[model samples]
Target: MTEDGGRRGRHETEEERADRMWGELIQEVRVAQTGVQILFGFLLTVVFQPKYDRLSHSDQVIYIVTVVLGACATGALVGPVSLHRLVSGFRVKPRAVRLASRMTFVGLLLLLATMTSALLLILRVATHAGFVPYLVAAVVAWYLLCWYALPLWARRRHPVRPGDRAPDLPPGGPGPGRRQGRT
Candidate 1:
């Protein structure tokens, strides 16, 4: 019941944008929440195992830190659900979306830390060779490259200027499928 009677209407306002953004955020949260929950569940079971006791004090410390980070990540990632529950129908969706986006961003950072530390711990325990740290560092670099660096480089390098034309072709151009002929 909006301008276009659907999602293709006028530009969304801060409030409408918030509502829309919230829906998008919820979808995003579903993916991250599932992952964080699975990770947290797995982390919870490690304490009961026998090899867990054999871990060095340092490894144990890393495990504890990783678990804490994973727990925090889960909480922050799931914060949007609680936030939506608390703020739904309050007529302040714009602010809620912004807040939830921030929380989700923080949650992603926490998830990164949790995963990194978890990887470090697993690699350290599974292979006591001197090259474990190096291997972990390489993997971390690859993650950073794939997750952040490549996108950043693309964004910076292929930026659109203010006067740049869009990729739309005019009425009968060589766009989709059109061979020149009669009308």
Candidate 2:
């Protein structure tokens, strides 16, 4: 604990870091879970609408697929909480965190697919023009850019070596201390 206080940059132990990460992950899940749940609920109601009966067979199929995707997205987004609950007190928090993170990523991907499908269905129903596919494709591209491409690009642009200290840490925050010359 050379002047900076403790081991890690934020002077946190392993458990402390895991705790912080879990908190952040939970907050993120809350936002995504709310969205997916709402979308799924709405999707569930669409079949009961009077207009649903007027849709062509192909459109009905698309609606069915979209609703299924929404349900899957909802499950994936809610998975992390279930994982945490089942694995609590198991003494494998780091591993649990990793698994939860993976679940969250999968959940986000599913959510993207659900959203794209829903948008495609909506656009098709709203307009029978030839531009619907192009429009949906453009929107999908935008979602990919926002969701994956930018984050990957930034990560590649600023690579961190294995032993490198965290950026958010201040100078002399936490690392091996320098040794003095022998007398």
lDDT of each: 0.74, 0.76
lDDT value for model 2 = 0.76
What is the C-alpha lDDT profile of model 1 across 1-183, one tens digit per residue? Answer: 233443322344446655666787789889989988998899999989999999999999999999999999999999988988998888877677767877987887788888889889988998888898888788888877976678566655664443231222234332322111110
Which residue pairs show collisions in model 2? Answer: none
lDDT of each residue in 52-145, candidate 2, tens digit only? 9999998899899999888888888899899899989987776676677778888888899999889888999999878998999999999999
Listed per candidate, the RMSD to the true structure in angstroms reads: 10.5, 8.8
Report the error of model 1 at residue 129, Å. Answer: 1.7
Give the poorly placed runs of model 2, Cα more than 4 Å off.
Answer: 1-11, 165-183
